[model samples]
Target: MSNKDEAITIVSNFLEASMAPDPELAATYMAADVRITFTGGRAMASPQAITDFNSGRYAWVKKALGPFDWTEHEDHTVVYSNGTLYGEWPDGRPFAGNRYLDRFEVRNGRITRMDVWNDSAEWLLTPELNQES
Candidate 1:
């Protein structure tokens, strides 16, 4: 596998681990300094922080990541990823089909920074997403 391919594999495995409900497994892919910026200016700078934020939201978080479709510019590899994460809230209200697009910058095969956008608006607007609020 080329560098990007390897990165994609790692990214895919990361998502798989999340669905495994193993925070330790899921965390291996993240650099200690990994930085993730969600829309609405919500940023998570630590593996623990990101895990904590997502872990509580649903019973299972599953994603299918592929096609990579990337460009390398200077020191940054701009990659576009489309995938869906499925899970449910703590209340036993099931929510699946949460889709997302993520842009990532990888340095030395380590993800340094990321920007993510998702159709979670659908999740949020749904009666399921609203129940939490």
Candidate 2:
């Protein structure tokens, strides 16, 4: 497979592992010194840190993955995966379509860096908008 294909596969498998709520499995894709940045400018050093953070944010959460858009570069492959989230909130209400964007830097079949963005911060800023439907 090409670098682009490898990047996509690595990202796809990582997402699948994450949806399984298996941070250990997902971390396998990451580089030893992987850098992660979450929504709201929260920075972390590893994939496991992201999982730990999310556990405190929601009662239970899972990603509804969409598609992967890959960009091949000389140094690394950049993969952008866009998706929505669906799960029970801490208050016991279900929510979906919490749009998310994840950018991964893949090198030699491993993700060296990742950056995440989502709509949750906007919802947090607008407290009245988080109501149950």
TM-score of each: 0.74, 0.92
* Per-residue lDDT over 1-133 for candidate 1, one digit per residue giving the tens place of the 0 to 100 score: 6667766766666656655657677677767788889756689765556667776655545566646677767775666778766566667666555677877766676677778777655665566554333
lDDT of 2 at 127: 47
Candidate 2 segments whose C-alpha is farther than 4 A from its true place: 127-132
TM-score of 2: 0.92
- For model 1, the stretches where C-alpha displacement exceeds 4 angstroms are 25-27, 128-133
* Distance from true location, Cα of 72 in model 2, Å: 0.8
Provide the RMSD of all predictions against the true structure, rounded to 1 decimal.
3.7, 1.6
The candidate that achieves the highest lDDT relative to the unseen native structure:
2
Write out the backbone clash pairs for model 2: none
